[model samples]
Target: MIERLPARAFAAGVVTLALVSGVVSYLMVQPDPAVDTTRVTAAPAEVAASASAPSLVTAAGLEQFRRDYRDRFGDTLLDEATLHDEYASIERAVPHSPDRVMPYSYRGTFESDHSPTTRPVGTPEFDLDALDVPLLARYLAGAPQSVGVPDGSVSHVGLGIDVGEATVSIYVSNRAQENGYLVLTPDGRVLAVRRFEP
Candidate 1:
């Protein structure tokens, strides 16, 4: 009976700790959806579509992006359907400004799963313009995950044209290991998703 008493006390303590932890977590995760629109002409759209975001570039969008890319550069090696399937599940799109002329950009956070001190919280851009679907499609198609995998290896896509240097890089989880970046062009033309060493 004495041993039982100790066990009961331990269980009670554990329950109390769990309750406290849950309450603390709930308090911490409560979101304050506040936005400052003092500088903007209009406030943010209240009916932000969570279902449609981060926006899936259709098969046609893919072709247009290819057209724009080809118009500016040359013919691309990327196929329309192949690119569409890659980013089909991008559910959340970070909001972006439309004044920018650059075609490629990224948004959101990427805290290194392996490193404690590394945080890739880039507010680059994810705002797809009225006709920027093709650009987004290009980026999505260029993602390594969009590529086909080999027998023992992961995604191995070799169908992109390199435009020398790029400023935008999107994160693509490389199986169970490192992350990849989809480098894009000004008009979302040339692209590649290569593994980045941490």
Candidate 2:
């Protein structure tokens, strides 16, 4: 004799079969584990040497040097009244010295409205005496010749001095509003003492 299955029973059996098949398929598929470690390496000896080297100038040393600079050349560069005036007018008028051409030993370039565009990148050393500015020539004569770094912008109190033949630039965050000067020297003597600002 033929037997007939109930509709509800037939549906329940089909659902159970599907659930079992899904569980078996998932268990059979497993992920593989691998990592790429190419960038990891031991440190170099030069890096270790650089990390251990001592600095040439310390913060205290720099302050002492600045104080010495003031004491030695302060009078020739600027008096108290002039310094105050320069500070007061620093925001308005900043004097730009003539383009100075020196040997490419120490070279730096900065952007300024006054900077000359046609100036050679690596100009040979020219005689400072040939320049019309006497103070600049004198400063170059007295100071040890070195290269000037590019000073980006003129701050409230910017200082430029000749270190050897190269110009060293300094910026003062707090300038007295009475008077000031831009002094350049070769052998530690004041070169050009121009009233930088008002």
Deviation from truth (RMSD, Å), model 1: 24.3
- 1-198, model 2: which lDDT tens digit per residue? 111111110000001111233322100111122321111111111111222221112122222323433453342221111011111110111113223321111001112334222323333221212222322222222121111112211232222212224222212212333332223222222223222232
Residue 120 of model 2: what lDDT? 32
How many residue pairs clash per model?
0, 20
Q: Write the per-residue lDDT of candidate 1 for residues 1-198, one digit (tens) a residue.
A: 000000000000001111223222100111123411111010111221233232223325334434544453343321111122233111111224222222221122111122122212432222222224434443344344322221112122112212322222334444555554433333433233234444
Tell me the TM-score of each prediction against the true structure: 0.25, 0.19
Q: What is the C-alpha lDDT of each candidate?
A: 0.27, 0.21
In model 2, state the lDDT of residue 3.
14
Give the distance in Å from residue 35's predicted Cα in candidate 2 to where it truly belongs.
76
